[model samples]
Every structure is written in C-alpha cells, then in structure tokens.
Target: MFLAQSFVFSLLAITGLALPSNEGVKHNNMARSTKYAPKEPPLTTPWTDKVGTKPWPEYPRPLLQRSDWKNLNGIWKYQNASDLNAVDSPPFGKDLAQEVLIPSCIESGLSGIQTDWGLYSWFSTSFDVSSEWKNDKVLLNFGAVDYEATVFVNGQKAGFHRGGYYRFALDVTEHVKFDQSNELLVFVHDPTDDGDYVIPIGKQTLRPSHIFYTPCSGIWQSVWLEAAPTNYITQLDLDANMDGQVNVTVHSSANGTSAQAKVTVHKDGKTVATHEGPTNKPFQFTVSSPKLWSPDSPNLYNVTVSLDKDEVESYIGFRTISRGVIDGVERPLLNGEFIFMFGTLDQGYWPDGLYTPPNHEAMVYDLKVLKDLGFNMVRKHIKVETDLFYRACDEIGLLVIQDMPSLRPLQSVLPDAKQQAEFARQLDVLVNQFKSYPSIAIWVIYNEGWGQITDTYPEFELTDRVRQLDPTRLVDSTTGWVDHGAGDFSDNHHYANPQCGTPFYSTASSPYDPSRIGFQGEFGGIGNNVSIEHLWNNQAAIDTINQTYEIDTTIEAWNYRSHLLLGELEDQIRLFACSGGVWTQTTDVEGEVNGLITYDRRVSRVDEKQWKADIQALYDAAAARSSNSTRDSL
Candidate 1:
C-alpha cells in the first residue's frame, strides 16, 4: 500500500503537475513563471549582476571535492508562514506564491523577496538525479540555515538540523527516485531575538541599531547535491605541521571493515609522498624540506585519498600557531617566529546579500584587498563564513581569527539547561567542522560577554574542551569582558577616545598576566562616512555618528581624526608590547559607519598606498622591537 502511494506521487511529480487537495487549493508542480530580480539595495558590488539565475555556481566545498555533484543554488518556490504554528505541515504539492533565489537569505535584497521579517518560511524545488548517479548514494547538503530547518524529499522526512552557522547534510538516496523528478521541501523557523529559546545569533537583530544589524532569517549559503559510492570517504582529518610530519585520518561510510585508503600528497603538480592506510585510522607521511605556509609565502600541498571505488581531492598547508616568550615577553608566533598579526575586524555582511556575499569573486575581493593593503590577518567577527571564504584565505595566506557567534542575552530565554546544552553542542560542531582550515589560527569562544552567565557559564570548561578538540590552534576564552583568564591570550576591546593622548586605551588598569599574551581584540573605531553616495542610509549614518561617536564633523575632519587615531594606536601597541590588535571593522555595516572601506565597497576612505605603507611600517616597527629586545636580553 505504501509503495503504491509513493509510486503515484512520483508519477504526478514527474508529469509536472499535482492533484488538488481537500482544502480547495490547487497545487502546481510546474516551474515558477515569476522572473527573479533582486530588490534594489542601497549598495551593490560589481559582481552583483554576475549573480545570475544560478548564484554561487562554484563548488561549495573546496576541501572535500568530487567530480560528480550538482549545485541546487537557483530559483526556488517560497511561501512565508504567518507564524511559527502555521508551519506544522510541509507544503508538499502546494504552489508557493513567491519565488526566491537559493542561498541568499529571505531578508537579503539578493533573494528577490526582501521581506522585513520571516520567522517561518518554506522553500521547495525539484531536481532530477543524473543517470550516472543511479548506482551512487545521493547526499543533500546545506551550507547553513538560520535557526531550525526540517527537510523533506518527496514528502518524506529526510532530516532536521538546528544551527545557523554550521553545515548539515542529509542522505536522501532512498527518499529520492533515480529516474523521476524529486521534490525537495525545506521548512525554516528562525526567531531572531523573538524566540523563547537561546541560539547563537551573533549580532543579528530584528530591530537594527548602532551595532546590531538586520537578521538573516533563512538559507544564507549554498545548497547542493552530491553523489558518492556506498563506501566513500565522509571526512578527512589532515594534521600537517612545520616539522614535515603529516597525519591523515579518513572517516568513511563503508559498512565493511576491509577498506583501505591510498593517500597521495602533491606539491606543485609533483607527487611528493604517498601512504596506504586503513580507513578510520591515522596514518603518517613525511615531506622533506617543507615550504611552510605564511602570509608572505602561502604554500599548499595537494592531497588525494582513494578508496576502493571512491576518490576525493583535498589540500593542506603546513603551519603552527603558538605563543612563545620573546625577550621575556610572550608574543604570538607563527612557525616558531614572532610575526605581528596586523588585522581588521571583518563582520561578514554584504549590502545585497547580508550574511551571504553576492558571489565568489565578491568574497575574494575583500580578502585580496586586505592582503594588498599589507594586512596579514583578519578577525572574522561574530559570524562563521562560507567555506569558500576560508579557502580564499588559505590560498591568499591571510590568517583568520574565527569567532563563535554569540547568543542574544536579554532577548533569548537563556540560563536554562536546554539552551546551554544547545550552545555547547553547536560549539563542538563548529570546531570539528572548520578545524581542517589552516588559515584559522584562533577560536574565540566568547565575545564582549554577550551571552555569558557570569557566575555559572562554565567558560573555563568550554575553553578546555575546545583546546582538547583541536590542540593545533589557540583558544581564546573571552575576547572582551568577563575574562576568566582561561585561554592563551588575555584579550580586550577598547574603542578610540580622542580625549587621551593615546586614543586607544585598555580598560584593564593593571598589566596583563605575563604568562598569557596581551591582545587588543578590538580598537580603532574611527567613523569615516566620507562617501555620501555610498551610504546605506544617510539619516542612519548621521544618527550613528551623533549617538555613538558624539561628533558633528565634516568628512575631511573625520578622516583626519581617523588617521591621527591610527597613529596614536601604533604608538600604544609599541608601548604596551601587545601581540596584535584588530581595527573595529573592514567595511561599514547597515547603520554603523565606522569602516575603513565604504559599505558599497566602491570607495576607500583612506588612501590605499598610504594605508599600506603605514601598515608595513607597523610591522617593521614590531619586528625591530623584537630584534632589539632579544639583543638587550643577550
């Protein structure tokens, strides 16, 4: 009886039609007739138009590559539920009234349906499995979905995932028909600062203000389908270090225990090393005279792991991030040498795409521009970016200090057991998922005490667990306030105060512990709303400048003040002997106008050549200080 029902459903779906339900709503399975046109945003990049019908066509997962895959990042039917309770059932065969671009959030202008807030939304699309993939298992992957998501393949529940910033996959091989069209339906519920449950929401808020911006409600990253053999590599954990030692562990989906993996390491198209090892076991290989990965020389070694019938390609870079005592002062070290991590606080938000960048080129442009400006590192502030962003960093040699998104404090129903457990689980998933990226040097567990429970939050315990999970990288327990001094760096955040001779000042009166490296986590928030045409909202910018900075000044005056603050910050860094500092931001977000670059990305507030030279001078001064201190100690 069940087989007959499924067969009838498949036949109806394949015919590009659906039966009318008892509710008198006619269901249409035909392709959407509505054309996609992104809503006119306040600002857009050159690559905005390049995000055609099929956006983010590039393979989403670079670390784990396969020749056979399909990008499901195109037009999809969508329906906004009136409330959370209205999303009780999946709209299996119902025709959605609206169309939206996949990957871009419903709130983003790039999604075409830029509604104010969508707490509950449904998205449906149809895809056909290739004939060649008939013998292989089909995996449906979502880069990320805000809050909670329930997926259905051909009206059958496939999987459910909760987390706004982590990737999730559902094996829909059995649920999908190989020769017929398969209907994919996703129900998303994201209560951004409106829910009773606590989830990691970062700086997203429905009510946008000075610091917090608009919420990314639903699917904000790429969705795709991948074909894999039954005995395929599910994951590859590569641990490559500066000592020329490489450990490869392959996690597989094989039911039998007899599968062995042949691993090959390549450098510059030449095979450097190979090792055959059993699946699910760690195996070792060595590369002699390894070219260490650094900001100046970002060398990556290509790797391929082949099982009996499944093979996957990946890449790894050899580097180590640690803290070392240099001339009796602790400092951040890359590959056993002190390297100043001059960086910017990069909140990954776009005017058009919100949490998602318009396209791959737009994403690369930000990192490339930072690199060209002589900045070696970036603090990915409060948001986990798509894998492509990290891949670009790896290739471009920009160090990343990845921050875990914080939960809303006053809004969320926190201090409960369930919310706390969810936070911990999501944190674990985040660490395990992004541990393979060599560009990620530090894992910031908490930021500014946003969601921390002062007395009972277990900050130290959480920090220890993150360290245990990935001992290769550093773990920062607290980035700003409520520091338990539990992690590698005693980090702090301070904005520029023009009243002081040194605009940048640390809140801590006493010196930081000599055991832990002192770090200026955030500073230099100098408002430069220079380009009037590129402003997201003119009045908002004016209000922000007035309320936050309390200054009514001209563009030239603000820019001059910015340069003066930066000069003072350089002196402060030298005086404090801190490891590194991050300027408040890279680009202006929604209302907050204090950015080095304009929100539109078309205008640079500072002269690029002069900024680069100034940044290089900071690096030179830091290097000179290290050398002089060592000489004096000798």
Candidate 2:
C-alpha cells in the first residue's frame, strides 16, 4: 500500500513479464494501416457473432448498484484516425474501419482493430436512459478504461479518468440528456512501457516477453450506471480483530441514517453462529468458535449490511491476519492459528481477451481451477484485478497477497523526490478499496524492488508508506532482498528455483543473516506444457501437423518430470521454515511456458492427484515442525 526506500541500490535484471496493451512503440498511435502481425486464435464463444454484440453486459459496479442502466456495449462506429476532429459528424451511422469488441483491449484479437498501439483512439456508443433514471440519478461507470479516458454524454462532456488498471465512475446524471438517446464517447491515450506513477505499469510492452503478454487498454472492464438516493452507502470496510470481534466501518453521504449488519457463520451446511448489530461507526460482534477462515477449510460467515430502513444491502466477511511469535519463530497467524500460504503469482491474463476476460464465467473458471488444484492463496503480483475477482476469492476461500502494481520511477535507484508522495496517494486509495475483503492476507509493498533499488540494510523500501496506510496487515518491504529492516516478512523470488532462503532465525547463525520469516514470494517455474494445450491458437490447429509444430507433439507424449518439478519445488516450498509461497503463476502466458494450465484453461499439465499429495505433505511437514518446536521448548 506504500513505498519504502530503505536499502541501498542493488544490481539485478527483472524484465520479461506480462504485457499490457500499447505494445512496442515510440508513440502509442497506430493510425496507419499496417498488416496485423501473427496473432493468437479467435475466442471460442457460445454466442453467435453479430453486430451490436459484446460480451460482459452486466452492470459493472456491485457496491453502488443501480437497475435502470443502459448498456453502451454493442457495436459502435469507429475510425483509425489519429485526431478526434477528423470526423466532425457524430461519427455514428458511418462506415467503420473494423468492428472492435467492447471491454476488450484494442490490441486483443477479440477487438477486430488490432494495432501495435493507439495513443489516440475513440470509442463511441449511444443509448437511451429511461425516464425513471432521469428522475433519480445516473452515473456512467467504466469498470476500467486503460491509460486515460474522456467521457461525453449526450453531446455534453461528462468526465475523464487515468490509470488503466483501476475502475472509476462518472456522475453524468446532469450532463446526460433526459428523453433522447445519450451519446457516450471515450478517447484513450495509453503508453505502456512509458512508465508513469499515476498508474502502476505492469509488464505491459509493445512486445511482450517471458511472463508478460500484450498490454490492455481502453475499458478492459464492465461499464454501467447506478441510481442512488441523495444519501446512500458510500463505502463499507470490514475490520476483523484478533479478539474474534468483527467491526464494520460504514461511510455514507448522509448520517443519522442508522445501519445494522446481519452476520451468519457457516461450515458444511451447519449454522455455527449468527449476529446482528447496529453498524453505526464500527459496530462489534463475535463469532462463537469463529470457524476461522483459512486456505485449507476457508470457513466463512456471510454478512449483509442494510441501512436503517433496510434499504441498501452490502456483503462482507469477518477475518483477521496478524504476525506473532509461534514457539520461538515468528509467523503469520490467520484468525488465531498459523497456516503457511502457498500458491502462484497469478498474473490474471487471458489468451483472446488479453486485459479483459471473455466473460465473468471465464473469470470464475480461473479461480475455480486454483481451488481444484488445492491452492489456498494467490499472490497478485504487480497488478490489481476487478473487485469481482476479490469477491470471488472471499466466497471461495482463497487467501490473497495483493501487490500494488508499481509505477516505474524515472530512475531505478533511490526514491523519487517528486513521485514518492504521488505514489503514496495512489497507494492510499488502493488500500482503502480492497481492505474489507477477508481473503486478502497480506499487502506486498514492492516486487523484487521494482521502482526503488534497495539491495542493502536499512532500505527505504516504501514499507514506511505502506505501514502508514495499512499497519494492520503485515507488509513485505521488498519481494527479493532489498531488506531495509522495514517489512514483517523477508520476501524473495527465485525462478526455476532449486533452493529457498534460510529460516528467519538462521539469518544470523547461518550465512543468510537476521531476517523475519522467509517466504518463497516467487519461485517454482518449470516449463511443462500439456499436449496440444493450446498455448497459442494458430493456423497449425487447422492445417496438417508440420514438424515445425514440434512443441505440441512433444507435449502430447509429455511425461511430467514429476520428480524434478515437485521434488525440487517441495524442497523450496519448505525452506527457511517457509511461512508462505507465491509460486510463479497459475497459467502459461505467450512465451512463458511455466504455468500449471494453458491460457485457454482447457488442460492440466501436471498430475492433479500427485501435485495435491505433494502440497499436503508440505502442510503435514509444517504441522510436524510446529509440534516439534513445541516439544523442544519444554
């Protein structure tokens, strides 16, 4: 949630990751007609292709919801023109260069307009708002529009937003015309590799590498409107303390309007406990035998918050995370017990959809896979996802170590005197938005010291800023060794890793030195693809099996190097009395053939039963260690 520049400079190369839209370019403007380069396969959808048809049609915002909203998602007229003034006319009913899908990045295959980049491109759509919406209120919401966006509602200007990764809403209720069809226009300018602080740029490149795929831009999420009373639920923050007491923090435009939270604890169809309270300024309640939420069991209680009059309804969870000394070593305790979190660094990328998932069902599919694979946690490395993803994590019981995407500073050395404060501001909004979810276990400050190079002691690794924003959650100052004596855990990332860092205590006795609990923040990348798993869709799928497509044929008869992949990974996942793990990734991206599943989400490369057994063994080992430590103390 914040930046720390505690340590001195370190020399390391960390390129070759996921790519956003706005691919390779001096300028992100591909107005000229250039032949489309080799692309992936077309997305296979149940729906028949037609005009005015785009996937992801639900009202995007679940928090501030409205029913009387028109979807501006269908087909819209467009031109690959550089400037906005070229076509003076509304640009409607005019011939278009090619139909591009909404909620998908322009660079993606789903969006017909595949260009290297578009610093200047316009998205226009028109819809009629019901008179009901006119009477109450209207808000135009873009689940997220990449880079920069400007809105024009019904010939009148509305608002604009930057930051391609986060979501935003504009109250166009006033600017929108009442009776007539409203015109909504968006102009986006996204520079991917051109790192900026306002938006933390991920592995977005004009040309994608190792883990990075193509960059996504211009509304990769859902967009809709909401109508609310003059006084409505502004925000809800769920705070679960170690006392087993849960506090609900509600913020609204109007006060004196009472609020109560109805909570129900559940496990295997048995109602454990239920509580309801006047959720006025952090109401507190306790769960009996509080079926603590964890990766293994993920026991969760349902919470429904209603206004004084039972007007608006919102849902949250009751869970707490804290760091405490267990036996002699310190470890992260969930709810009350210590459980080691181990999982992949989910990049949240799709083959055809790129930035956006084909649909919500597809989005859920990814999480469900993680569950099936016996993963209790996921480290969202260097990127953020829609709240819906977090919501699913809450309901499904996946612990998240969310990393705020880093804004690449001008210099890679110390903290930027100018950008430091700005990064802090963005970090504040990020923490406030996702703090309530029960699945989020830790807040990661930096990934391998991305922006600030802190290779030595007392590193100013942005942990100070992160702590100020969210001291509740344990902070990992820097993923790798930019140790500045800041973070709660000494995080590290090792690719194709054979060994893990020494235990926190061993840092002094051993060569590693004094450190907190060590985690395999990143490790375990073994290139093992399934036969015809479809890493990239291509003409080869239709044509004869040429020897050139050797990878697929090789994988068809692929015997997983189980001993090498897991024997080594198991050893790594157990190192330094490892408290948690953020495995490389869940699925394979463009070039990085190091995912458990392919991009299409079809095949499982590894043996499920065998993998689970290995993971379970790790847990058993930890349990045994905890027991041994207890015995030795006596």
Candidate maximizing TM-score: 1
**Candidate 1 lDDT for residue 170:** 86
Residue 332, candidate 1: Cα error in Å is 1.1
lDDT of 2 by residue, 341-448 (tens): 878878887766676676778788878888887788888877788878887888788888888777553334344556555555666667877777778878876666
The superposed Cα distance between candidate 2 and the true structure at residue 415, in angstroms, equals: 7.8
lDDT of each: 0.79, 0.60
Number of the predicted model whose lDDT against the real structure is largest: 1
lDDT of 1 at 1: 12
lDDT of 2 at 512: 32
Which regions of candidate 1 are displaced past 4 Å?
1-34, 255-258, 409-413, 497-511, 538-542, 550-556, 628-634
Per-prediction TM-score to the true structure, in the order listed? 0.91, 0.79
Misplaced by over 4 Å in model 2 are 1-54, 62-71, 77-98, 195-199, 241-244, 254-290, 306-310, 409-416, 453-461, 501-515, 529-533, 537-562, 568-575, 628-634
Clashes per candidate (backbone, < 3 Å): 0, 38
* Candidate 1 C-alpha lDDT tens digits along 1-634: 1124334443454465854322323347673534556765656767776787788898888888888899999999877776666556667887776778999988876887666677888888999997789888899999999989999999899999999998888889999888688999988999888746567998898877778888898888899999999888888888788988887778888635757899898998899999898887778888898999999999999999899888888999999888777877777888888888878999999988989998888899888888988899999998999999999999999999999999874523454677777888888988988999989999998887878777775789899889888888888788876776778877767766311113244564223665777777887777755555777753553466544452425656665666666676567556656677788778888777777777878877766666777787778767865884552110
